[model samples]
Target: MGPETLLPNGIAHYLLGGLLIGAGTVVIYGATGITAGASTFLESTLSYVSGLPRFQQFRFTATRDWRVVFTLGIVLGGALYGLAFGEFGWTTDVQWWRLLGGGVLVGIGTRVGKGCTSGHGVCGVGSLSEASLLNVSVFVSIAVGTALTVQALGVSP
Candidate 1:
């Protein structure tokens, strides 16, 4: 089955979102000469959060405050989209603690993986980087395995 039935909107709606993201990626690269990646943005935000001068000296955040703005825009865009769709409800079937725990694990995994799926799968692979190709392979394999394992265990997460 196609995503049309599973999604709240038509395929065109999803396509538009993809197009917008692609345009944004191009714009970011054109403006900053840097491929946009969310994880690195978060890492920089964390550096600022920790209030450590050493973290601020890191190559990631040393000269890239715009990344933090880009990250905030991403988050704000998501919130605005949900509000626009009138589907802004956040009543999840999963427990809060489970969600928090999962978020922590994902954060850890992103650091260990050196980037998130957006970095490796979207930008890196698009750039034809071999390391990103390998990372995407491992990421997809593990994600598929996890989904299948959850299905086997009848877990709803």
Candidate 2:
């Protein structure tokens, strides 16, 4: 196969998306002194409905508003993109129950890991945080292993 066929189309779109995410992360930190991580934002948004002290901490409550807005922006942005120019349907053959189970496992993993990839990979790694670096390394290693194992098991999706 030629080099042109080796790469997917819309490569520029991916580049632009990455740049925008990085820019948004920087702007969020520069303006509000908060790290723009989705998992933390998810936790902070729980402050409104949950009475749990873990979600009611000063750090989460103090910046919950903007975090909520940021989270909304992420959801809306993806929706907008799909509405504008993309396959606007669920094309995956994966079952809803499997998806739900995977999401639950991911949520638990994030809590145990203390953060998600966006926190450790984007903001933390950008700032050269040791803990973030370590977390990201483990994240990548596990992800690679999981993908390989699934592929070996003939999982197709």
Give the number of the best model, judged by TM-score: 2
Q: 79-148 in candidate 1: lDDT tens per residue?
A: 9988888767776898889889978887887788888877777788989999889989987898889889
Candidate 2: pairs in clash: none
Listed per candidate, the RMSD to the true structure in angstroms reads 2.4, 2.0
Q: Top model by lDDT, which number? A: 2
Judged by whole-model lDDT over C-alpha atoms, candidate 1 comes out at: 0.80
**lDDT score for residue 45 of model 1:** 68
Show model 2 residue runs off by greater than 4 Å. Answer: 1-6
Show the lowest summed lDDT stretch of 10 residues, model 2: 2-11
